[model samples]
Target: MDKVIFSFLGTTLDAGYSAGRWERWRPTIALCQQEDMIVNRLVLFHGGGHDSLLKLVIEDIHRISPETVVEPVRLQIRDPWNFVDVYSALHDFVRRYPFNTEDFEYLVHITTGTHVAQICLFLLIEARYFPAKIVQTSPPRNSKRVDKSEVAIIDLDLSQYNQLASRFDEERKEDVSFLKFGIATQNSRFNATIAEIEQVALRSSTPILLTGPTGTGKSFLARRIYELKRAKHQFHGEFIDVNCATLRGDGAMSALFGHVKGSFTGALQARGGYLKAAEDGLLFLDEIGELGLDEQAMLLKAIEEKRFFPVGSDKEVSSQFQLIAGTHRDLSQDVKDGRFREDLFARINTWLYSLPGLKDRREDIEPNLDFELERIADQLGKKVRFNSDAKKSYLQYAMAGTTEWAGNFRDLSGSLLRMATLANSGRIDEDNVSVEIQRLKARHQTINSDLGVDESGNSHQDWLELRDRIDPFDQVQLAYVIKVCKQSANLSDAGRNLFQQSRKDKKMSNDADRLRKYLSKFELSFSQVKEW
Candidate 1:
């Protein structure tokens, strides 16, 4: 590969312009002589206002080494100290420069120009605006030593440095911790998943699909990923997050793909939608399973083509944005049921991570208590603390097998907010913990009770009481089945509804018989269903 040097023009005003006299050695020229290897070309950035100095520098480069090709780039800027102006000018200049990384090896001379200009160059390099290494030049102590000598080339690849690499790893851990809101979790699998996510966020723009139960922090993590990417200057636009579950029919389509003026009943003006709003940024679709088929088709097209036509608009609008989708529902199952598009699922499934539910990451619960408390304090302007007894009591109950956190982090957050609000003198006592625990239990019991209601308004609590009676997998499935049963007029109706889509592919003679036998395994029947 041919060597190419990218450097800024340093003023030679310090050196007298007297005939047959030179005070200082130019850093750009010195950059060329640092190593024995010949630099094939030089891409030099110069202030457009300084034409004479530029000419003199070009002459000096030719005098020192005529074989080296010089490409002078004129950048207009009033002040080097004005970082915005200098950086913008340099950024535009480099962007317009046709760079072929495969054929030429590039080196940025960080030694020349004002300190501000050097910093901007370094930032551009770090942000990968150019594929190059930095080179710094120093003048010899004895001015009489006119031969350009002192120079050091800097390689910004930190992975090569053991100590610096370790420091970076530590900082990455901190970043992951911040993403989790300081939840000091010890679960190895969960920690490893987070580490993987961190890598994906930094390295790839591929659509990420976060799958997990509701309130499992999928949306939170998606937003955090956007923040991380934005902080790194990977994205310049705002993060657009939309919960797909709340969208319905025309509203869903319009909100996602936008609508033209007079497109629908209420679209009075041309709407830009979430996609256009997230141009050059990130779009996090929480509960992505709920989007309608037509919307999904359009979304698939947009993801692939980076352009889509707004409703009732002939013109196609373009948007380039990273996508992060979150969902509690099994999209594969949805695809099989013909509710979700298989093509869309396949497109987003490339970078999929299943975020663990609160039950799975129980170790994180304790630290989350403090996080919640701090969050509440900031919002309410009142500080609160869980006393020793209260803290132990709450943790014990929360960590126990009976305490099913159905709502996951949302449940934990709500529990802490209530306890903190009810605390006496800014301290939550054992009584407060006990009351909150009982309240949570009642709320959960009420939900389970609703699934197993009898004719006489008795809470059979079949699902509630069977906490440790059956396998957790069976327990969850059966609970859902029973819940559906409560809404049906009869066992046959419940069975048909439950297997409405799945039974289509099966040669089943009696859906009711199949459901009945399944219920018998759990000692449940239709007669038990009424009002929980």
Candidate 2:
């Protein structure tokens, strides 16, 4: 019996089948089923689609490989198009299903479109999913042939695909670099802070706790640490990020540690949890403060002992992952309130760093704004420039207002993106600045109230009122003296200004002495008083 393997690529399951692309797939499917041939098992992979397509692909594989075993893998790729998920799914599939080329003679990949095919090719080279020869099935540009069998097979070696994948990865990596530290981009403060955090990441095996206001770049910093650590050493492990808030009660334990088959009502098969996925790499717990007290206790044990038993499993699994925890809440306060474990807090706090808010670093605003604008322009595929007046006005507006930036870097990036979209000729004017500032004030009014300021303007008003309240007498006296001197200078037509208004105008020399005494009380020289 012959053996054949097929990988189907498409935007969605139905589209690949309905567009007559399934015809090309049929040839590979038929080849795998043929007895006395060089084919036996048929492997099919689907990408990015509704579940209906996945079911259809599985059914098709079963129909083609009745005598031979059929293995089907469907990757659930998240939108906003993150390739990490695809790589992870493919790698997992390869690990579980190791193929023997001696039994299988042909391995074919049927591609739906350019991008889907390109990513799969990249994953193959980087992940080394299979040792079989790789080929791409490209449709004829001007032909009306809609059958999968009509698809052209382009033979490609590992090196050629590897180079292309490397270039693709490099381009993406470069783009992500802007999201990294000290790059002239939106959220540069967060990026730079994250870069600094990464430096200390590898120094100690202790768990790290990143505390900051929401959207202050906690997750970003954690990811950077993982990337840095991965670069420092060749660790074949995954960086698994989990939101502790989402994992309530049993779900928390199930997600952290693996669950045995029939462990719970929905445990159809034994599943490895995030701890197993992370292995030798970093496991980031985002919003760690939101974890319930019971869940916290479980997590603390895992951190301290580097082991956790799966839910409903008697066996203890070793999880030697580098724990990177982050939270927007004050964990110490949570501990005092008996909401968080003190021991857990102490363990994670061994390496702690607080990120400064956007308001604290006003100097970075202009540069960050420029970098964000450039990014927005590049993404929109349009050229944008800030007019001199608009630029000055916007900067002045940014400087004058005390925006706490409750959302921090994320909020700033969003505001800049909106401004760029609405700006005329890429020029954000004073009017635009004013409108955006008002919007920001309205958006954060509750936060402002909590901080004891109704708005930035109100803060400025309060400052003026406080100054008046503190030195009411001094202000009144200074104004009165300055007014009198001006009047005297005008009346006498003297070359020099008057020192002060005499208490007794008719007393002449007596009044002069009194005024001199008054000047001395205020630590003013007679000559200086005259100048004043």
Candidate 3:
């Protein structure tokens, strides 16, 4: 295979007005003269008015190596120092030049060009505008002869460097851990999801939607994503956080897209809102589903086009920012119910990541317990540790299915804070954990006693009084049966659903009587349950 090198013609270095030019080694001539690194063809690029120098260098290269081919090409660049002109000329030449990797190996000679020319060539080579390795030549230690020149070839492909590749892998893992709040989370699925979220947050500026129940770390993860991107220099502006639930009517509009003076009855002063403040940064609208339809429409316009008219202002304002939305409510359901704008929902739903609640992630509780203690130490300036027995006892109760973890991470953090605050000196003993467990059990029972509504976050006030009197275990079943009764037309309809599978074995399925007997256990009648 023929070995080819592309290089710029250094007019002064390759020129010889007299015999004295032979004293200094010329890079182009030396590249061809190196016995260890043979060059079959040289494509020498030079600007106009360098024909004499170009000819002299080519002749010198051929004098020492008779078999070497000298291919002199004129770039016609008025200024070799002008990057734009030099790059454009070289780019066109590269496009037109025949590249056959199977028949030839190529190298970009960086030793002889002007600084600007060298930079252009490096940029083009790194971007793979042409396929080649970079070859650099330097002056020999004690020689000025072309035959003694030093040559170094560097391959740009990173996969070839094992140590550097391993370093990058380690950095990527550290970034993933950052997004997870440095938690040693054990769930495989959750870890994989965090990895995906990390990648998406870094590589894209699109709107990211994080969905989960309350206290599942939607807001925390959103802020972490912002922090990660900011640390990587992806964002330059501030982190704008807004809870949509706090926004209402004119106030919501004013808070999001600025408001001019006299915008409303209480428009005391002009305001620059979150969207503008988040320019070149990230805006986390926690509980984004709580946004009113009008605000949603304006937000859609602002997010889609980066321009919007603020409240009571005819002039349009512009801002460019990244949007990350967090919602505990099901946005798809909000769109169906006409509570949220469908267009806005679709726009922000491009990268949706759902976080699992604490109850669903039992394995992570232990690690989070340690993390909470670490946080407590940081906040209170007092270090605390759980004894082995206390830690084991707490983990057992926390991992059990009976533990609701209603507020998820917040609830866990609060529980740990209480235990740590009450710990004897710096040690949490077994007795402390038992008291905490009983307190958590009582808290969960209180939460269950009011579990009268279905999954849609509705409330049934009538069932609350009856629910308060029921045992924690019985509250769930009674609440579900009451839900069916409320949805049913009458006693028989409710009875059939309540005894669905059991009625199949009856010779004469008196479902009403069976349901009546069941309702008596709760001291409730169908008519009363239904009416409520």
Per lDDT, the best of the predicted structures is 3
Residue 138 accuracy (lDDT) in model 3? 81
Candidate 2: residue 495 Cα off by (Å)? 38
Candidate 1 clash pair list: 453-531, 453-532
Please list the residue runs of candidate 1 whose C-alpha ends up more than 4 Å from where it truly belongs after superposition: 1-141, 153-157, 453-532
What is candidate 1's lDDT per residue for 1-532, written digit by digit as tens?
8889888887752123444434456577666654475878988887877677777778877877787899888788888799999999989977887889989888898887889999999998887786788877787765566455576778787778999999988989888886776778787878888888998899999999999998888988988888888888999998999999899977888899899999878778988999999999999999999898899999999999999999999999999999999999999999999999999999998999998888888888887888789999997789999899889999999988657888899989888989888888999999999999889978877876666532223346555576458886876777677678877888889889988876888777688999988878867677764354
lDDT of model 3 at position 320? 96
Worst 10 residues of 3 by lDDT: 451-460
> Which parts of model 2 have CA positions greater than 4 angstroms off?
1-180, 184-198, 374-385, 424-431, 446-532
Error of 1 at 246 (Å): 1.4
Sorted on TM-score, best first, the list reads 3, 1, 2
Clash statistics: count for each candidate: 2, 10, 0
**Tens-digit per-residue lDDT, 1-532, candidate 2:** 2545556534342245564554543433434433434335556565544566566655664665556565655655553245566556666766787566676555555444246445765557444466555544444356444332233344446357887889867754553463355454444565565555544665666788888778767787777777766776834588899988788767777787889999999999998898888888889999998888777787788888888788899998887888889888988999999988999999898778887777766666787776677778887677566677767867776655445677877888888777777878767776777788788767787666565442122334433354355466764564444345434533232212343244235334354455456546656434543443
Per-candidate TM equals 0.65, 0.49, 0.79
- Indicate whether candidate 1 or candidate 3 has the larger TM-score: 3
